[model samples]
Target: MKLNLFFQLSAWCICLCFSPVLAQQNYRNNEDINKALRNLVNNHKSHASLKSLTKTLGGKDVWVLTLSNGKPEAHPAIVIAGGVSGNHLLGIELSVKMAERILTNYKSVLNQTTFYIFPNLSPDATAQYFGKLKYERVANAKKTDDDRDGSINEDGFEDLNNDKLITLIRVEDPTGDYMPLEEDPRIMVKANPQKGEKGTHKIFSEGIDNDKDGVFNEDGIGGVAFNKNLTYNYPYFKSGAGEHAVSELENRALLDFLYERWNIHSILTFGPSNNLSVPLKYNSDRANKRIITSILKKDEKLNKHISEIYNKITKTKDAPKSVTAGGGFFEWSYFHFGRHAMSTPAWWFPKFEGDSLVKAPKNRKANFLKWAEQEGIENTFVEWTSIKHPDFPNKKVEVGGIVPFIMDNPPYSKVDSIAIKHSEFIIEIAKIQPDLKLINLKTEDLGSNLTRITVDLYNKGLLPTHTEMGAKSKWLRKINVSLKLGKGQEVLSGKKRLVLGIIEEDSSKQLSWLIKGRGKLQIEATTPHAGKQSITINL
Candidate 1:
């Protein structure tokens, strides 16, 4: 009874937690959604755009909802886009949740900030979950002839085993290139090419190749993978990533709105790349091992803990194995415009951090199986079962794997926790306000017609005025204090303000300059995020 009550309570919280989503209609029949989005644009006092915000993509309008502090001209902006691939419901939910959070907490986060929030990038794809999805496919409802032999989504598969799961099946053939599951012994692996060892295996999707394209049903369904369609590493001539980067009207519409409206300083996108969380590969580029040391520098206990579980914790791939590259979000922010950017995985297979158990490599699959059963992710991947195949024989099909909604897609219960944690991180970084003000200025008049003016610059927030790299590269603006007296202001000696390296939270740096014969003079201070301030002096 207690366990049942816990689940009931969890179910209730799911409903309450996603009440915001209740406001969002299914994209297919989302007339109400359009109206709600339009209403938000009209009602919000801060600058917002409902005009030219939507564009026809694959025969439907994709909407771009923007929020900002009222400004006369285009302000630098950040675009947080989700539901790009259509299958990623968590992405859409998070982006919307974040926008809502920002609006409610406007006094703190939304100040001097303009945000472009597209909660659902692939509305067509998202509508699949409306009542029941046939095969759990359909992110964009795109009927593209994926195999290009001329039919569309025609060659699809199904869960013939009654396991309620769709997975690859391997049948043993004398000429095939896949081997029996070596690691898990129940799963299969691609045969090694170097050994010239023959593999007697043939792999097929859960269903027949309805189109008979000689390659099974490779081109299943849905709109293009939007992230893979961006211009930088745009899979130009590659199959479904699109004709070019930002080629889809859906992608173009949002890109146009962001680039035109906001001069974004930084971007923290949830994707498959990294900048803020550096892959080990970048450490060699810096040469200053301090950056690497700083991250690995903490908690010897954690280090010792990892040593017990993982033999090779070295990061092998910071990117996908695919050759068709879409110069992703990290590149767009970091390389193209020189903005600080970070892209993190929304979820990953567990790393052995002592927080999770240390399963032997041989027992890894079994451990995952055990945990999945306990955690309820087993709802997706069914147990390995035998099945008869037309092409090959004597094969047991393991329908269970990591391709499930539970782990790859974190539960709604975790959204609030991650939101609060990420929000705090954003605030911590946001505090790097370079804006210095003329807090105090005093002049002591000398009898010989000379006066000394002192100035103080205070850091208004958390992060220091400049990063060590920013200071060294002069990428960050220099804070200068000047006391001027008309033309040819008699100056004793102009001393350059000293940057005490990095300034911590709520710290102040002071400067004093001397000048003679002052009729009218001005003193000013500057920073990147805080705008600027100045004051006038006369004697």
Candidate 2:
């Protein structure tokens, strides 16, 4: 009877643990994220722990959730990061949901692998979505002079239509570079002079020119974007790249933590820069450079392989528009930090399917507008309404456009499916990580208390022991093999310690140590990313 009661209580506890998910609707706020993380950690205390990396300028904590079965530092680790770009709300949700899924469903995998998840990095800017006025914000709460006018946040967005939304404001001007698309007048496209098209409107963020600099919303609220503030090829003096690379407290904290954790072999970042749906190409010219600005040839092949796995696992066919990574975390993880880094936004707007005779609009906004309308998604676009602008006096100006964050993120109801697929893909990647083994052990007895120990060290998994970039970097630790001698044992020949470079998948190396030992000898092979294995031989 007591056992039955215990089983009933366990079922009740499981139901209570997931009750918060049923109540979830919109994207979580900072408070909700904190609560969710706390609940997940408490529920999975045996394998998970939560800690704050640092606090942002807005006093929001940048939290790190770690999951492992044993000492996490000893196992190969994958860093799953999100909210590198604040406006990409889906990234944070994916990160948090993936963590929860892993803990709840794939907890057994933690025995060989460790995961570090930073669910929300730009908490200050992300909080703006739940604020009184909503707009797409990409930076943290630190004040910035984006226009370099010697004033911080002097000019920002305004809800000109009094709708509490910061959309777009377009002014009718013949000399403008923007023109309405032929298919959808609600969307604007750049005029093509070669096509005999001329611009009829000037587009700006919904705001009056508060600084009177003839520019609208140039210097907006918040500061450097975390996604833009990284070390690899830092965009110096460029807007949103921060005063310098690794400047923010959040970036510094993450880097400081990552540098010490040598077991981190791969990074999966949820952000604007994606290489999973579309793999990065190998540029031979750049790859041959002394500075090595391109992905190494072998690494590019691995990327393609991983992309195939990602597409197959997710079954997603839509290809997102390609984006460059300049001073971005994903690029830094590979080029500077020397780890296999993969990034994805997890979801994007599927291609609109209309009559082929309709001739699709070249403008992205128009394409989305038409698609949203066909799907009966209401309130996605604000109808253009005329408004008198303070900057462009006597000019025809209007406030209207697509609502912020709607285009990038799907509805909350669709998140569970996307998260499940992504979690499956991540698990596939973890399963393929390098597994080192010691095989074919033999000991040959010789006279005069001498013995020979022979063993083959092999990488039995599909992935290499270390990434190509990791092998190139002196910072990454190499695979180490050492022999521990019994009492009164000395090395007669062979290396007592051997440091080997990148061990390709299914590759093996045979080593025999001639030792002057009395009874038994031990050999151990270890790598930060591949874990460690040992064997003992009696002579």
TM-score to native of every candidate shown? 0.65, 0.94
TM-score, candidate number 2? 0.94
Best by TM-score: 2
What are the lDDT figures for the candidates, one per model? 0.53, 0.88
Q: Give the TM-score of candidate 1.
A: 0.65
lDDT tens per residue, model 2, 1-539: 99999999999999899887776878989898899899999998999999999999889999999999988987899999989888889989998999999998998889999999999988988988998899999888888899998999988888899998899988999999999877888888889999999999999999878888888888988988888899888889888888999999999999999999988888999888888998998998998888889898889888999999999998887767756658888889999998989998888877677786665565677777767777778789889999987788889999998998999888888899999999999998889888789999888888888888788999987778887888888667998999888888899899999999888877888988888868777899998888899988777
Candidate 1 all-Cα RMSD: 8.8
Cα error, residue 267 of model 1, in Å, equals 1.2
